[model samples]
Target: MASDQSTNPPIMEAKTRHPLHQIADTPTHKLLLKQWLKEEELILSRVSHKESQIDSVRREITQLYIFFFLFHSISLLLLFHASSSSSPSSASASSACKRSWIPSLCALLSSLGIIWAVRYKSEVESHLEKLLEREKEDAKLLRKCVEELKKKGIEFDLLKEVDALRRAKSLRVESKPVRKWSARDFVTLFFFSVSCLVLAMIRLILCD
Candidate 1:
């Protein structure tokens, strides 16, 4: 009777942990830690490449936007001048109106070009920002893994993979061009711009 009484100490059963928790608590931690380090390194490389691309795109957009903005502004000024020059007192009001319409149409065309440029600029900026965000997330994940690795007393070599990945990334960056443009495309754009200006001038003279 004493065995079943308060004199006997109760046996406690051990609590069971989930498999995922078990893995985190064991050798799997080392593997996961290594993966995070590698992931961070890969992300760093990818982000660097993306940043270079963004920079190149930004330069192009900035230069084009300035040209587009000035073109539209000039078109507007020409339209205003043409309109103001037309007077009700003058019998040539009809001719003035015709000339004004030509510049006004050119102004509309230039404005549309500006709108397209802005849209493309916004898209490039958005893409660049996404790359930056992904890089930040990778960094956060790497930090988490490093803290876990430190707790487990893992070797420093596990972290060296990041440096290797970064070095590889640097190699790729070095190989990339600051700008890439074809001679044919440049010639085409130049000719097209000149044609547009010439056409605009022709219209102004003919309509007048």
Candidate 2:
């Protein structure tokens, strides 16, 4: 039963999105289309900006972790080598060398910072998803309105402009996939924090 549950996790229900009303038969169809097109433009703009933010935050966090990992790995090696070559008399001093607290404190702070950033990343992603879903819902209504306008032999200038804007080189969504955070991501972060803290403690152990 447990294995089945794990293999077939229940799918989450889609959240309700704010809907755009279709009023294609009305005399004010043009006005409604114009308002909706403007709203669609705003949604796309925000999605683009938020996606960029998520990318930036991810890169900066990855680079910071790499920096700390290298610094501590080298420190551990040098400290170990120094302890091996030192005489018994200086053992006490060498052991005292292990009491270094700066790197450990910094590691703790970095771990905290990364955790916080990961949370921020999650929030941004959730917001982006909501925007995309809302856009999809609105698209359905917009298309219905367009079809009605077309059948009536009415041409909408705003609709044409919006379609052009959507096809614009700058505004269009790229082909690249948006990366999702997974269990592996969380594990990697946990391991990084633990490994750094352990190494710093090893330096302290060397002193004793």
Candidate 3:
């Protein structure tokens, strides 16, 4: 009887063992896993790209703030000097004001800079929000895929893998290095400095 039982497995044993045994090694499961892995890679790549874009936008915003501060400082200094009671300085400042449009030009540039910075910041924030939403959706889909695989009796620990990926992404974000100022930053600074110097020279000439 025992030999017969061994030769012909019982119905319960057959049912239980058929679906669970070697399910992960089957062709269908292998194909599913392959497709899932590809999707995982694509999502990871997109997340990385979005993070880089966010960093770039942040740097641009920082530059805008620096520019705003610089312009404000110059405006304040000009105002103070122009308002001085000293005869020579006041006379010079008055002459410069009459001959050149430096104050108005600076004000206009400052206003434009502020407007552009606010607009750009809003746009970048919106884009970042969309990317974050997409990331959440991708993570949800990955979890669902993992659940489906689990139901199919594929015993691999894919949920753990997904969680690990998420943790790694968080770590990367948390540890993001400060970016060095780029050539564009230097160029912008140089241009602003040169413009200010020219304006100063014109004012001095008018004063004389």
For each candidate in turn, the TM-score is 0.48, 0.50, 0.57
Kindly report which residue stretches of model 2 are placed more than 4 angstroms away from their true locations once superposed.
1-27, 81-94, 97-110, 113-185, 200-208
Ranking by TM-score: 3, 2, 1
Flag the better candidate by lDDT, 1 or 3.
3
| lDDT for each residue of candidate 3 in 13-65, tens digit (9 for 90 to 100) | 64466433545547666665667768877877888888888877878777776
Best by TM-score: 3
Prediction 2 global C-alpha lDDT: 0.58
- Give the deviation of candidate 2 from the true structure as CA RMSD: 19.2
Q: Encode model 1's per-residue lDDT on 171-196: one tens digit a residue.
A: 54323357666443464465457546
Give lDDT per model, in order. Answer: 0.59, 0.58, 0.63
Taking the tens digit of each residue's C-alpha lDDT, what string does model 2 give over 1-208?
9877765543221112112222333456646566756765775676577567657756765765676567566766776676667675775765556555655565566666655665565556556656655555455555555455444433345566556545552454545568887664785677566666665565564655
Cα RMSD to native, each candidate? 11.7, 19.2, 10.4
Of 2 and 3, the candidate ranking higher by TM-score: 3
